[model samples]
Target: MEATPRPSINIMTALLLLSLHGFIGPAAMAEQPSISADQASLLALKQHITDDPEDLLSTNWTETTSVCNWVGITCGTTHTSRVTRLNLACMGLSGTLPPQLGNLSFLAYFNITNNTFHGSLPVELSHLRRLQYFSVRGNFFEGEIPPWLASLPRLKYLFLNANGFSGTIPESICNVSTLQTLDLSENQLAGTILPLIFNIPLLKVIDLSNNQLSGAMPSSVFSESPLLDIDHSSNSLSGVLPQNICGNLPNLQGLFLSFNQFSGGIPSSLSECRQLQVLALSVNNFSGTIPRELGNLTLLNGLYLGVNNLIEYGSGGVVSTRGDVYSYGILLMETFTGKGPTDEMFSGEESLKRWVKNSLPDAVGDVLDAKLLSREELTAAKLECVSTILELAAHCCTELPGERKGMNDVLAKLEKIRTVLGQM
Candidate 1:
């Protein structure tokens, strides 16, 4: 009879148990949302086959997690959830760039410079509309630059230097009106400079050095903007340089045109750029008297007019052989003190060389940069090495060009000094 009443299996009780199971079962476990397309793109990059695999890059990469927490992935300043900068410079990463990087729509700065990356630049990068600073220099990338690069409306800096890239720089590069810096130096690119490059309204820094380019120096360059620096050195470019170069560029600071065939009178209008700091025109065919107006450039720090047919003039209206020397002395002071010359004698070639040579005997505490002087904890051996460097520079600046050591010798001496310093 008790079996008949068996557990009193009431329907209500069974229903209650079922309801509890529904609310407290394994099926109730929370599931994260699947990785978005942007995250998937990043994951694909992690799978790239590298010649020398970096285990550190893969330690925390996972499909279901936020990439913002990944190493080397810098997040946005305002919104930490989005990646803004990707700096993998000098990481020894070797692989074709994965197109998946374009998925990072908010990325503003991306630098993979000084790596072993090889292969054509992926056109898919055009999709990163917000990119501002993009640099992949010193890599083994080979191929024509994709024209799609010009389509990035927000790009401000682009550097593809020291790569194996071959072909003329695309004219479309100049179409990015907001570009502030563009460096395509040390490549196999050949052809005339694109005229459009001079037309960019915001371009401030440009380096197209060590290429096979040949043409007349564009007069329009720096004609419309406050370009601060320009380096077209070591190209086959020939012809007289543009006049009014510094006049047009009020903020012109550094100008490098060394190792070219440019010939003509130095532009007198250069004095207009009072902010000029470094002017390098060495190893060219420029002739005529050194513009006395150059002395007006009070902010000038490094002026390299050597190896040219430059005649110096003095304030007394006499042609002075010390003119070139004077400029060199200014540069020496700039390099040594990190400051402009305190007196005109420091701007004279012979005077500077003599001063440097005589000062070597008592050089330790006073001759060195003041900033470096504050380090009283420096060892005697370290001071000796630094004094040796100064001595070498002094020798290199000898009044007689033939007696002066060559740059190669100067560099070797500097290297030896560095080795000694390193040991100390």
Candidate 2:
């Protein structure tokens, strides 16, 4: 018969009820830290971005938006809703990273690859104990790689390549037991590689190429490691390669040592790496006949042995390293075609050997350099001699190193060809 009288409350009681029911406006809620530490850190980074040509962060990342919804920001869903991953790769965003980024205690994966971010990496980054994958590749970041990076207890992949980072690679980085791949290529890093780097138990790949590193390789390097790929090319590393290079490295897949000052005979034990797919030893000062045992590497696909001083076995024996045959084949092709293995005309799958091998028997004239023989000098006898040399080279370039021709056979055939040419 009567509606219940509405209860009256004081202004303070009304405000308390609204707050308890979450009916208060953002202006009131903002009084108690609406922005999180993660948001603040991200904002600090945004302030350092001098150029955001794509407006990726400039437009999407704002205080009005939820930090988790921002572009390139991924927040955790299962547990605490904190920033867990920050990936801004290839956005053309130019900026130096802010030290406040270390405040993202939950950050796990961080990548800024192929951007123009420059300046030394802030030491505060070492605070990211949960970081798993950290990459800053293809940027202008410089200064010595900080030793504090080893402090990341959970780091798995670290890519610091294609930058201007100078100074010796910090030995302490090897302390990361969880590191799987460490790529420091294409930098200005000098000094011999630290032996401990090769000893990390879980390390699978080590790329130290295209730097200024010099000095002999550590004697204990590569022994009993699980490394699958080791690239030390385009450096100043000298001294004889270890005779037992493939020792205990059952998983070795690629060994790139090109464009260095490495000398002495290639280790015959390289044949032990049955899984080896690519072996690059070109542009070095290696001498002595290649070990015939290399032919045993049945899985080898990419073999680079050109530009070395490898010669016929001084013993004049029929047995020669299988690698020597491949080198000789490449040499023969270069001599006739005047094209180096690194010729601009050759790249990717197309190589000097492949070019000559494909042109053999019928299209010999096509591969011959004009400097090698003038049109008038290209008589039938001369053409036959040239063809024989190219044929020998093709045999040396066989896909399987073991299946390639021996140097003894190659030398004899070459001598006979010369004899015939001289008589003609």
Candidate 3:
């Protein structure tokens, strides 16, 4: 699980909080402060918090003090001291949100992440017109995500991950034009994902992983979407992946579809996802030869094809004697460079083959395994033989499948190199 992140506050708000409490409070001790509607709403919310072992709210939220001075409260500087942000993330508070909180018209950011908050989301939250960021993630919230969430006109980031939200995701959520990130992972959400959700104009990240969602993904064209990362892994989804999955999502970077019942050949068109860095298709019923075109994605750092029915392919996209040569070449590089193809260091236009190719022939020693070079009896002949092996690996890893050397030729070269080393 990712660590809960703190929301960012403006410098002006920080300064205002400091000035009101640090400097002004000492001089205004004798004046009487009146409670506003925002204050009443906050106090009402405080009433529902059944557990506060730290006495955070009991000691700080008092009738005598201005609500602006309360912890997790930030009043807007221009909205006549109206509460604009309430962040109680990871505070260990347990409670349900009060409907009265919807009255805070100026609220733009609200977060109660990693808390024990339970019960379905209050429908009153639909009235938060100015709200931009809302997170109730890592909580005990249950029931279906409300359809009224689409009513928040300005909502941008919506996170409800790691909860008990069930039922089909409301298709009405596609109405949020300004939404950027939507995460509903680790939930009980079911039903097929609607295609309109993928066509949301500005949506960049969509995570629906670890859910009960089923059915084949709609074959609709995802046009004009700037989506960067999509994780639909660990679901009951089935059917062949869309043939034109990358046709419209030009900025797609991560495609994680593991642990599902998806069948049929992996789409060859996926190679068009030029920005793709992580491609995970493991633990599925997918069968057929792996696409050789995938080798063209130099930026790809992670390619997981384990626990599947995929097979190695030879030239012209068929299983043959040369089918296993490409993998054997990668094995040679791995043995020499002491690096796997998916090593963290080989991201963004770099791979085990590319790394070795850059330092071949003359500088091969630099990329060679240290243990091999450290042998006291190792001679220049063995070093040259290693260089020859890496050169063979380069031939096998050519971007075009037909250009790759056949397994027969590769084996013949390796045998000659071994014979030469033995004579030395």
Candidate 4:
């Protein structure tokens, strides 16, 4: 629900609209000569909302007063007083838009958020080529996303979230090359998210969450985009997410694909996103052990993966504490060796605990912590104590639950090792 960058206003368009005052015919003479293209559009907008209980438009927007004097209207001080920005957010206005308002040639920034405006967008709005930022968020605007918006060259920010927009997200929207932010969440937009959106060079934020967009999102699209935030959560999107998403999109800061049906292992490549601040993949079907590499993202602030099949989700048929022992063994290996059971190095029958157990006694030096090796001044007794600890860890992580030492026995053995180390 982010507001995007406002478009730069065209001063020349304002001047041209003002000069039209001299060309007024005898019939147009009845109308005020000072009323420019934007003022006329404002009057059409006023007509739609005057029937509301607020009477906001009828009270202030009148011919007796200059449009420049109206509320939410900002006119240029240079040559012409044509309106450049019209902000009427949270006004509680209710009605449909008029086609006449598209005549605002100089209009650049228009905000009508937090209103009750309904009905589909007018085709006439396509005439506002100078428009850059147009937001109707928190309204009841419905129907298909108009394909005509692609014709606007200067349009950079389009916010239509929290509406009733339906039908396919027209591929024509990708035609707006200058677009920097597009928010169409919280609607009924169906069909696959067209990949052409990735071509938008300046696009930084894309919130297509809370819709019906399905199918696998292409990871290759992230390779070149400088996207700062991507929220595709709360949808029905399915399929395995490509593992290279984090590596491909280096500048990515936030990635939200939660509450979907995505199924696959948590990508180990996610460790490459050094700048990632938030990664939300909760309530999905992601499998495999949590990648220990994810701990590498130093800047990561949020990590949500609830209700997923990380370790276990649904019933695993017969349950036992043996699973706890298995988890404990994995944790023990990961804690000391700093490698997860699901790490790329451990595949097929190989695992972190198995590897540590294999190199016991003789090769304990090879897998032992490098910091422990640095303790060169230590006596041989301490080294023997370290080997005993490794053996205890291996015993806790035996392949069979029946063969593994019970918790009480493991604790007793740990105490014995502690006593031996403490005496030295």
- As a whole number from 0 to 100, the lDDT of residue 217 in candidate 4 is 70
lDDT of each: 0.74, 0.85, 0.84, 0.76
User: In model 2, which residue pairs have backbone atoms overlapping below 3 Å?
Assistant: 291-321, 292-321, 295-402
Candidate 3 — worst ten consecutive residues by lDDT sum?
Answer: 26-35
Local accuracy of candidate 3 as per-residue lDDT tens digits, 337-395: 87766677875324677889988888888898874566665577788888899999888
Candidate 4 at residue 143, lDDT? 95
Q: Backbone clashes in each candidate structure, one number apiece?
A: 1, 3, 0, 0
Q: Write the per-residue lDDT of candidate 4 for residues 1-424, one digit (tens) a residue.
A: 9999987769876555655865434544443444566677888888787455566677888878889899888887743666778899888888889998788767788899978899989998888878999999989999999999999899999999999999989989888988999999999998887777876888889999999989887766744777888999889888888777765567888888877899989888888877787777866898887787987898775565654667632213533344444444444554456565445787521456667778776666667665344457456776666667767767765656667676567667768887987777
Model 1 lDDT per residue over 1-424, tens place? 4546556668878766876878544433322121255567677776773754566576666755576777667766553356788887877778888988887877899998988888988888999999999999989999887899999999999999999988898989888999999999989888888867866899989999989889887776545675788889889998998785665677888888878889998898888888898788877889997787999999886677765677653534544554444344335444565443334557644455566667675564466665454477556777777667666666555545546565555556768877876666
Best by lDDT: 2
Candidates 3 and 4: which is better by TM-score?
3
Local distance difference test, candidate 3: 0.84
Higher-lDDT candidate of 2 and 3:
2
Question: Is candidate 1 or 4 superior in TM-score?
Answer: 1
